[model samples]
Target chain A: MTSFFIYKAILVVVVFGIMLMAAMYSTYLERKVAAFIQDRVGPNRAGPFGILQPLADGIKMFMKEEIIPEVANKTLFIVGPCIAMLTAIMAGVVIPWGGELVINGVPYVLQIIDFDFGLLYVFGVVSLGVYGIMIGGWASNNKFSLFGAIRASAQMISYEIAMGLSIIALIMMTGTLSLREIVEFQAGGTGSTWNFWNVVYQPLGFLLFLVCAFAECNRTPFDLPESETELVGGYHTEYSSMKLGFYLFAEYINMFISSAVISTLYFGGTNFPFMNDLGLSQNAITILGTLAFFIKIGFFVFFYMWIRWTLPRFRYDQLMYLGWRVLIPLAIANVAITGLVMILTDRI
Target chain B: MKSLTGRAKVLDNPKMTFKERIYLPAIIGGITITLRHLFKRKATIRYPEEKRTFSPVWRGMHVLKRDDNGAERCTACGLCAVACPAEAITMTAAERKPGEEKLYREEKYAATYEINMLRCIFCGLCEEACPKEAIFLTDRLVSTDYARDGFIYGKDKLVEPVDKRVDVSKRQTPNVLEFKKIKHYRHNR
Candidate 1:
């Protein structure tokens, strides 16, 4: 029991370290993508094609002076970014990175904790992500910050409905809220055909989920909360130093979490096609599966950056209209269609 | 009012077509364009490491010329200073001393000459007005400095070095050489 606990502790530390490193590099990739789209050479100075740029950026962020507004709420002001960073990292807990790891003939499931309602827990934690922005904006005592906070909360609340409804259709198809179970159901056991990825069953649901994921993460087209042209620096207008860094870092972490979740749900997490036929050992298969999962996750992250550079920010009214009128109705219709199809097929 | 050129499209905001309303096709088009750019050669010329070649007629910084024998060509005739629109050129004329014929090609030479680069427009008017063919603008850019005093370029900066050569021949076109030839013929006559 003590050894198992120690393993879990080690896993937590490793996962945290990976998450932080991925988030740091995402900033560098974002700049490179932006430069490429504009036909310019991006950062290639700091340590060979700017690979060590994130280290330089971290040092700069740490070395900067921290500032707090005189009229700001001192306690919540500091708590805001901490909460943001905490909630962002918390969303990764129930996500399974691989199938299993066997050590000394004892098989251990490669997840932090396989909760019964893993999807619900993720959704709940992600929705709470808005509170950080809200508290930060309100505590700043600046109008722009307040406006940004309000916009973020409103947008998050509106999109959360569509996101939940989209997931509901998937739940009806899989009949399980545990993410690992969903993956297993789709994988169809070791040597089966790779025809059961959820995206084939839920295309419209995936689209709705994707759009809502963008809004939930406060990415472009839904990034009104911190739209530079309209709101200056928005919620972090008054924040400086590591506090600001924490807020920005939390955003990238949220992006990574959403990518992982999307890959898990639709792309069949850690289930590479024809893996069992390769005559590999259990440990090798497990390692390959983990690599495949990361590949899927990396593709989604690249897609996020691509869409961000391609699309322009939507107007406030258009944003709200899309979330409430368009996405919510489409998500509902998707759920209904899924149910009807399931019933007609006698699969229920 | 009627359109002047008959090329104006309607000003009314048209309703989006069904495909346009979905916006996916347009977004895909944009993504493809950016993806194309990602593979295209970047336009950024990394400065300091690489420099662009200047055009033949491009005038940059001033250089007081020397004849093939390395004698100063200026006679301090003040024509270039008179023609300078910015009043940037100033010189003091001195009679050629007894043993200084090897240094000065003319009986008179500019003893002290300066050009305030801060005021000079690099228009090549001084180059055009130099009767002795003393001053010409090369394709060399003036290096920036912190102090205004450093901008007043003296003879040490403007004159070509004795050992190292400065080529202002690119700025002297065929017409300019022809004019110089004609002037030399007139001086001989």
Candidate 2:
């Protein structure tokens, strides 16, 4: 038990480091990608290819003056970003990074937790993420901030239903709430007992989930809440110094976790095609699988930024229409069709 | 309303089709467009390291010229100061001493020549007004400085070095050169 605890502690630290690094570099990558798409050379000054940009940005954020509005609620304003960042990091605990690794006759899992209600935990955490924006916006005591907060909460609430409904179809097919189990269920290549990725089974569900994930992350096309033109600075209008950094950082982390969850649910987590067919040792295969999983996550994150640069933000009414009217119905139909297919094929 | 100008465009508020309403195809097209641009040549010149060349007739910083014997050409006739619309040029005349013939091309020279670059419009009128061909606008740019007083081009900043003469041959067009060859002009004598 002590050894198990030690391994888990190490895993936690490693995962935390990876998450922070990924989030920090995501900001740099966003600028570089934006510059490339616009036919301009981005930052290439600080370090080679601007690799040290994130560190410089972090330092600059820390050096900025911390401002707390006189009209704002002091305590909630402070608590808002903390909640946002905490919930963002907390969702990563349930994601399985890789398969099992054995050392000295003891098998250890790469995930932080394997609870049966892992999916529900992620959902609960994601739902709680809205409170950060809502509270921050309200605490600012400004009209634009309040409007942004309200829009954010409404958008998240409307889209969460669709996101949840989309997941339900996958859960029905997998018959398990544990993320590790779902990943394992999709293991093995062709001519094997297990199936391919869940995307093969539920393409519509995957599409719905992708769109909802974008909304939940408050990304472009679904980024009406913090639209800069409509709401100046949005929820973090009154926030400054590291406080604003935390809000922005939390968004990138949320994007990272959302990409991970999407890859896990639809792209078979760390399981790549012909992964088992290779005659490599168990440890080698596990390491390669972890790399493959990260590559999938990277692609998804790039796809998120790509979509962000490509699509303009949806109007307030159009956002609501898409969320409440379009997505929810489509997600419901997906769930029903998934059930129907399961029944017809006698897989249930 | 009746069109006042035929150039006015009448825009149609056409309803979106089913494909357009879906937005996926249009989104894909935009993505492909940006993807193509990602590989396209960047328009940035990366200033400081790479500078774009200016046009030959580009009027920039002023330079006081010299004759072939490396003597000051300006006789301080003050025509440039009079012709300057911005009233930027100022100078003081001094008689050339008997021993200073090597330094001065003429009997009179500008003892203190100054041009307030902040006031000058860079219209090349100074070059046109100089009877001695003593001042010309060079291709070199005026560097930025912290103080307004620093923009005042004194003799030290304006005069071309004796060892390294500034080439303003591009500003002297064929017509100006032809006019100079008339020799009837007092300075041309």
TM-score of each: 0.95, 0.95
TM-scores of chain B alone in all candidate structures, in the order given: 0.89, 0.90
Model 2: per-residue Cα lDDT over B1-189, one tens digit each = 878887888898999999999878998899999889889999999898999899989999999998899998999999999989999999999999999998999999999999998999999887887878899998899988999999988999898889999998998889777876776866556
Report per-candidate DockQ.
Answer: 0.78, 0.79
Residue-level lDDT of model 2, residues A273-347, one tens digit each, is 888777777888789889999999999999899888878998889899999899999999998999999999999
Q: Candidate 1: where is the Cα deviation over 4 Å? A: A188-194, B1-9, B184-189
Give the TM-score (vs. native) of candidate 1: 0.95
Q: Which lDDT tens digits does candidate 1 get at residues B1-189?
A: 679998998889989999998887998998898888888899998788889888888889999998998999988988889989999999999999999988999899999999999999999889988878899999999999999999999999998987877998798889887777774563312
**Interface Cα RMSD in Å, per prediction:** 0.8, 0.8
Give Cα-based local distance difference scores for all models. 0.91, 0.92
For model 2, what is the alpha-carbon lDDT of residue B185?
A: 69
Point to the candidate with the largest TM-score: 2
Model 2 global lDDT (CA atoms, 0 to 1): 0.92
